[model samples]
Target: MGLPGTIPPAQGPARPALAVVDVQPHLQQPATDRGPGRLHLSAEGASRAAGGSGGGEAVKVILLRDVPTLGRAGTLVEVKEGYARNYLLPRGLAREATAGAIRARDVMRQAEEQRRARVQREAEQLAQGLSALILEMRARAGAEGRLFGAVTAQQVADALRQRGFPVDKKQVELEHPIRVEGFHRVAVRLPTGRLVQVTVNVVGQR
Candidate 1:
């Protein structure tokens, strides 16, 4: 006798498959590098960390300057093999992302950071000196309180320089020229948004 219902189709057990992925790390390069050859750094094993072991599809390069539509200097980037060999390498705009080159870049970056910090410290010291010192400016004036001419930022900066302070003309935050001869309060601007209030003693030239 035949079964009452149609025979059921065969069923099988389901199994899961595993997928894997690989990742790589890159390091910094120097912006001031104008030469094309790879740099060999003395930093211990830093070069090894910057090394890339991948093959074929693309080539890695460290940028020497800011490239339009690309990236800024000191960055490690990958580009098409032909593009790197034909353009970037030839123009000295970048160097091969060699282990040694990356190491050297890191060293240069550290030195640059140290130099900047030193400059910041010096600027702060100068700001302190400017705050305690008085800047005297002489101007020709008539009988009235108003002076014949106005005092400019250049004059203020020069006064500070004469007092042994390295100050730029732009550092003097004088909104307008001083028209009268008297005591004036001026703000001296410093790097990192620091401001120092300074006293200006303007005297009318006899």
Candidate 2:
């Protein structure tokens, strides 16, 4: 029965009960079901997010000259592609490691090795000559043995040069300043990593 101006509820077959199909744990849909294509896309996206596509293949270069914080001449090193192209390649400090370039670099490396060996031999000879040398210096001193002024590395190098030894001030290593007038041992580091000890005889000036 329907009242006036009121619609009667339309009647039809009741909705069928939802079938609770017991799905096994393995058969159940995973919470995150990424398909093979999606996984591939995700992996590529991850790689891009990490860096660039070319990040995997860094540029290999041979240094033509010494680069601070990088390497010395004739050194083969890997660097970023952008850095290689922008700075090293443009400045002639490095070249790409191609077949021809590698061959040329090997030749240069051999020549550099020979040059280094020659230099090392010269340094060893110099060190051996300097080992038996003694230097004498005259400085003003007070009643005690202490001098009025300290002897410097430059003074020692100058003395060595006056005696026909090609020595630089930087190569002379003094642990402390020479203030007293006496015999002191000075260490000179040669280019070949040999340490030569020389005796300096210091006397008071009259």
Candidate 3:
């Protein structure tokens, strides 16, 4: 029926639909090109916590020497629950690389480099002074002219102090005691590959 002015009634309810296209570049990249293999994780997800059956966390290891658990510096290695908890984490050798941790690492690395440089310079100065002096040791000897005890690192340090060198006992590396000695080459580890050859003259005591 026609009226003067009128509106029509609603026909049906409206429903919403969602359309999705996978466009994550990180996800599109291959696993091998992404992380330290074995498990496939995107670079973005690698740093964060995992979502697998066994929840594993990422760790950053700084290797001073050749440590077993901590592979090397700048290496992101995954470790099991016990190994990281029992050993690595407690030793101040490694830490979980959260966003904050990564930033802190950069700062620490810079500070460490500066400290290393200062130590190297100090070692160089010590090396230069060590080269100019000769070490003398007086000890009781047998009839064959062999020393009763030996000229050891302590003896070397003592003599060095007497001669005004004042080197630490630890800096001297003696494989064996200087029993039969004339002039021996002692390796003093100095900075920047600088080495000093100090001559030790052992005289027989009365």
Q: Find the candidate with the highest lDDT and give its number.
A: 2
Selected candidate, larger TM-score, 2 vs 3:
2
Local accuracy by lDDT, each model: 0.74, 0.75, 0.60
Best candidate, TM-score: 1
Deviation (Å) of 164 in candidate 2 = 1.9
Question: Which residues of candidate 1, in runs, are more than 4 Å off?
Answer: 1-55, 68-70, 140-143, 170-175, 187-197
Error of 2 at 165 (Å): 1.8
**Runs off by more than 4 Å, candidate 2:** 1-99
Q: Write the per-residue lDDT of candidate 3 for residues 1-206, one digit (tens) a residue.
A: 54668776667988778878843222234455543322233444433322222334534444322333235554455654443454445745456656776677678788989999998888777787787656667788887888788888877877777776647677677778899746776766554556577777788764
- Candidate 1, residues 38-137, lDDT tens digits: the string is 3323233222233324333577899997654446787888766655675566767688999999999899899989999998999788877887877888
**How does residue 56 of candidate 1 score in lDDT?**
38
TM-score of 3: 0.45
Across 33-150, the per-residue lDDT of candidate 2 in tens digits comes to: 6532111223333234223444335778888776655667778887667656755677687888888989998887799889999999898878877888878899998888889998
Per-candidate clashes come to: 0, 0, 0
RMSD of each: 10.7, 14.9, 14.7
